[model samples]
Target chain A: MARDTAREPVKTGPDYLEVRLGIYRGMVRVRYFEKRAYDLFLQNLVKGTSHLAIGQEAIAAGVAAALRPDDYVFATYRGHAHAMLRGAPMVAVMAELLGRENGLMGGKGGSMHLTYTEGNFMGSYAIVGAHLPIANGAAWSALYRGTDQVAVAFFGDGATNIGAFHEALNLAATWKLPVVFVCENNLYMEYTPIRKVTAVERPAADRASAYGLPPVLVDGNDADMVFETATRAVGLARGGGGPSLIEAVTYRHGGHSRADPGKYRPDAEVAEWLAKDPIPRYKERLLDEGVAAEVLERIEAEAAAEVDQATEQAKAAAPAHPGGLEREVFSDGGATWRR
Target chain B: MTYREAVAAGLAQEMARDPSVVLIGEDVGAAGGVFKATAGLLEKFGARRVKDTPISEQAIIGAAMGAAMTGLRPVAELMFADFVSVCHDLVANQVAKARYMTNGQVSLPLVVRFGNGGGLRFGAQHSQSVESWLMAVPGLKVVVPSTPADVVGLLAAAVRDDDPVMFLEEKALYPTSGEVPEGEHVDELGTARVRRPGKDCSVIALGTMADRALAAAEQLQAEGIDCEVIDLRSLVPLDMTTVAASVAKTGRVFTVEENPRLCGWGAEVASIICEECFYDLDAPVRRITTPHVPLPAADSLEDAAIPSAERVAAAIREGLG
Candidate 1:
């Protein structure tokens, strides 16, 4: 079957105005949400560890915008932005960090494991490359059941070194499972730089040929580029072209977590990445694209207000229920299941 | 029917009953499993449900988790229990905790079946029993069935269970045949049965150890020391009701295990016996298990390393003395 070209999201296409604006709005919301979450974490309101995808918003916003609502998404620990851009309610996202009952995962998962099953988002995994094979399996389930709903796994550059990454890609391609492996190359594996740990000159895209899959690269800072690459990959998998790897060359502007200040990163490198910050970069592009300054400013104001309201609602929400905590040990959700 | 056939029968029954039930492993489909336990399943169910996966334990288990989360009852087969070391993260961290961490929004209806134990002399690497490793994991239910009938019924129940279940099938007992009951016989998870009842002493056993204990009890009957042999089919949801009742009746208890002595699951049973049935016991809970040592290759050395009927009888005689 011929791949559906019209399904791809284009920046300069006839629908550019609405498409670009949606991407721009999502990036802004993610930026604001991460900042608000960090500020709340400072006040000790958000418990546990939180990994903010602050500067890497374009990848999440762009990749999420490329897929259908029924398509499955599995992301890593740095998944707040990924969850939000996939249409997860900001209040629920914030509630999860606050350990409230109204959180995305009933607060049992806290910040790291936020899931929106209704949206087909499988949520974030703390273990680096753990979700890769799982994502392949979800795609296998879709294929086994004869559905075209492709699955996507979002991970960082560090995860590419893990054994699971090799195993998942190998199995996914070998079985022709309908899945996309998206590597958000944020340049650092926690405090250590990727270059210091990675063996090759670049990430292992050259090795993808072993799995009978294509290796594609895109500018992570450019939302339109990410969208285009992801759209093409998702389409290929849906059309039975097997799996694909999309290397989104990106950077994270903050510390590894809430505690580290990232002193290991040189000032020139930090300044270099900060200048490529997707939100401001895209906002400038929107203004240059002839969208009125007031219109862009209004979108920015709305994002801030929505995040502020979500923060307040999250703070006021009740704590997660303690009753029947024992029953959570084993699943009671399904005694007998069928497709 | 044989224990191996029972495993295949249970899997076939479940797959025929539910369209979502699938089997994934190395050589499980075309090869009909390494032990031929899944013999003819591929031809019956087709390759889609009875999948022959690459030799990747992580992918096999991880894919099962994903399939289960998205509404498939996946039965993943590991070639051996020792390879669980390779699939540990997916089982211990991912599949086991998903439902609880998600607060019941997700369910993992998955069963992991693997061949375990050291009696057949496959040597140290392939012959180790690792049920204690899985028993410590909270979200997992560990099961070990001795008889062919019990293996058939236990597997059906495990396939239907919502939680992740580890079904350890002893390699030596696969060819052993017994009178298996008719269809739709699903045994409850936490139930135990008294193989042979007596009043003077209670012999608690798990998996193939139950066979040895029963043999030992028969020999003890000739010696005029009455013994009650009990088969503990499930480990995680231990049948303490039957254990306590037996202990109360006999006032003497002995635990026979194939696993090593140190920190074995038998420790938990002994501790429970001490706590709940302390007044009912006339003797301290005696454990007849393999000594703390890695199993060597020679048949004689391997036999010495593991518990036998004679070894168990010795422990019983010592306890009675």
Candidate 2:
């Protein structure tokens, strides 16, 4: 079909512009959610220091979008974006940050330990690299029960050096498990730059080669690239081609936690990365490909409105109650009444 | 039946009863575990359910916790309790805290079996009684079975429980023969068993030490002093009611354990007895435990480190007098 070049680019495949536009919306939602979380931290509404995934939204958006409802996903402490993208209630996430009765975990687990088991987002682990092995176990359970369900573990660049990461990769490769290990290489492992501690090169795949699975490298800023790569990896895992690794190259725009400024990162490096932020880049791509600019603006405005309402509701909600503190401590009728 | 056979039978029964129950550990499948506690399981359950792993303790326990959370009942084996140190973080933080952390949204229906205690010349690294450390974790239910019947029932109960159970099997008592009741016997975890009836003193013990306490009680019976022997099957819930009743009747109590005397479960038991039934006691409760030293590799030194029946009897005699 012949189309006007300025508005609709010729040869835009079926659903091409629509898909990119949706991804742009997801990235915008994550950015707004993270910005509000940062504000909540400053006001001390958030119990502990919140780790912001400000610049790493595209990875969560792409991977979660690629997943099926039953497919499991385990993310690290920097996991707000992942949960948000998976459609967890924004008000519950906010209430969890404020440690309220209506929070995701009833205020039991705060920012770093959010869990939405019904959504199959098992948790966001506080410990680095610890959740990888659990992801492997979930994959093994799926395989044991003769299901095509796959498990995905989302961890940071620093987790690659830990023992759990190495053992998990080895076990997954050995058992031929259906899992996708995504390393969000955001340049810094918390405050320390990954280059200082890591022995290998930029792509984490270099290390995965030792475990017998070749890793896929993707431009984490571009959601289209990440979505395509993650979909292919998920396909292989479901079809019993064993586990695969994806090294997503990205950068974090915020500090490791609330208090310290990321002074360890050079200003030139910060400015350079800030210029390529995924939210704006993805938005520009969608608009250039003949997607309406009004759609992008509406998505941003809606995300801002939703997040503002959730924040106010969370901050004003009742704090966690002290009654029945020892409930659910152990199962099978343990009778140690602490009253 | 031997304790080893009881464990295998219990696991087999649970795995057959519930398809979600899975066994994962090193050498647990074809090798049938280091102590043969899992013998014939791989043949019955197949490799997927009765799986073997590398020498990765943390992965073994962590994966069990993971599997349990995702709707599988997992029974993981650590060859020795000493190796649990490697999996401490997974047990203490993840498996123990997951249900509470998630506000009851998730339950770890998992059982972690460890071959615990000393008297075997496995050296200091292999021969630690680690109940002291595992007990400090709040959400974990700790159980140590002395007899084969208790082993079978407690193992079955652990598989059924929604939370994590630290099912510590006494390594030295695995080969000891006993009449374990057949056909679906389940032990209520925190119920203490009264092995002997007496009025002079109450001798409370756990795991293999229960046998020693019985032997000590028998020796005291010859000296015209009667002793009631209590076997505590569970540690966390701690069936102190049975203990308090026995102490109230006997008017004297002695707690026995194989772990070190300094900061041990024996002291916790002694403290509980004092707190609950102190007025009923004729004398201060005594704790018979190993001196503060790592279990040595030599047989002579290992014997010296843990309490013998003679030592247990002596402590009971002193308390009764």
Candidate 3:
């Protein structure tokens, strides 16, 4: 397969082109969903902070595509894209953001904390690298049980420096458990740039060698490139090739969360990344192929309509509060009841 | 089956039943664990299933959580219960809270088993009973089984449970023999069992302390003081009703725990008893527990730090007097 990087767009695997196209559509769904979420935040339709997965949807769509229904996945706070692409009902994801009873978590987890068990998206952790150990534990269990299930943990560049990331990687490497650590290196940790946070600058995947694991860096913004790399890694893990570290090098187009306007980053830096938007780049590739221009427009329209429906469903979802919060704690039958 | 044998059996049986239940910890595969709690696991399940991990608590727990969340059931053995501090966040914050925080989306279903409390004189670092600290966490289900039957029953229950469970098997009780019924069994959390019923007083005990309570109750029975001994099998979901009912019936209560006295597990039970059953009590609730000091290295000093049968018998008398 030739690498498509011209008027014909980037060369993709001809055999799996539809698979790539399907994933690209999922990416567009996430892209538009996040954009609508941002709009809702502006209108105060959502509560708490919304972590935008903008410019990073390709990573979620690509990685989640290769995972089995029973496989485990853990993500950071900016996890709407991961949850949605992993097959979490769009209604619940939107309802969770709206803090409604019909949400995936019944409104207990608003944005940073979202979970969908049916899709195997275990949770989107609010605490930086804390989910690393949990993901490791789940993978360890799968390997122990003799099943070839793999656990995929997603985090930002800032999390790489935390003790949990180091500890999880070291243990996963030592035990040779089936786990994949995908670091969405979006250049900045909230406001501080990656260079200012850690001494390592090449890519987050470079640190995998320190733990004796196979590490790879890929073009995070390209949906086809990300899909190919993730599929290879997922295949290797399911085949008992131990664990791998994938550093999807991309950029976050928005601020850290809903609160910030990203004033710290220069306008030119933002503009440069916007020019390389994942959705448009993939659309260009499809147009160059036999895909019709009308089809492209139809897909965009469908994605927008889906996003609008999810938003409306979220707005109409019921409220869940103290009662739902009390159910998951302690297995015992009785405890204090907060009215 | 002995408590130790029961644990090994539970692991072996779970491994055979589910392809997703894996046992990993230091010395767990070949060495059969430090306490020999996993004697034939490696041979029966193979190295891939029964793993011996490096001495990294954080890594071991983190990996276990990862495995469990991803659709596997991981049973991790921390060499000693005292070592739980090394990976407290994974248990308390991550594993314990993940399910609740995620609104019941992720169920840890992870079993963390280890020997707690002192009888072998391993000193402060290795002998501390820190189950109380874990009981405070909301998402964790704390199970401290005293007998082989309870161990087998509770182990099965914890394995099947969707929430993260902390199964604290007392080091002293592991070698002690007891009858565990054949086949699979399960015991629910937060239900206290009455070992020996009496009418005069309630002797509340947890873990190995329940054995001492039974001994004391037998001795006190000869002395014409009938005592009802309650074994608090689970701490997190405490059966306060049983304790309160016993206190209401006898009008006197004596609590025993191997852990220290100050801010210990006993304090929580004591407070609950005083709050609910104080009106029916004839005497103040007395606790026979370890002193507010680190577990001593010397056997004699260790004896002083931990509660004994004699100490429990005397506390029962004090409460009766």
Which candidate number maximizes DockQ? 2
Real contacts recovered, all predictions: 0.62, 0.55, 0.67
Worst 10 residues of 1 chain A by lDDT: A330-339
- Over the stretch A208-304, how does candidate 3's per-residue lDDT look in tens digits? 7899865689988987778767777766766677778899988988888899889999999999999998889888888887778887787778888
DockQ of 3: 0.46
* Candidate with better lDDT, 1 vs 2: 1
DockQ values for all predictions?
0.48, 0.54, 0.46
Say which candidate scores most in lDDT. 1
lDDT string, candidate 2, B1-321, tens digits? 999899999998899899999999999999999999999999999998999998888788878977887889999999899998887878898888888877887788899999999988999998888888898788888899999999999999889988788999999998899997868887777788999888888889999899999999888899999889999878876888888889899888888889987888778778877887889988888889989888899998999889999989988777666
TM-score of 1: 0.96
Compared with the true structure, what per-residue lDDT tens digits does model 1 show for residues B63-142?
99888888888999998898999978988988878877777777788999999898877888888888888888878888
Please list the Cα RMSD from the true structure of every candidate, rounded to 1 decimal place.
2.7, 4.3, 4.3
The C-alpha local distance difference test score for the whole of candidate 2 amounts to 0.85
A-chain TM-score, model 1: 0.94
User: Local error of candidate 2 at A218, Å?
Assistant: 1.5
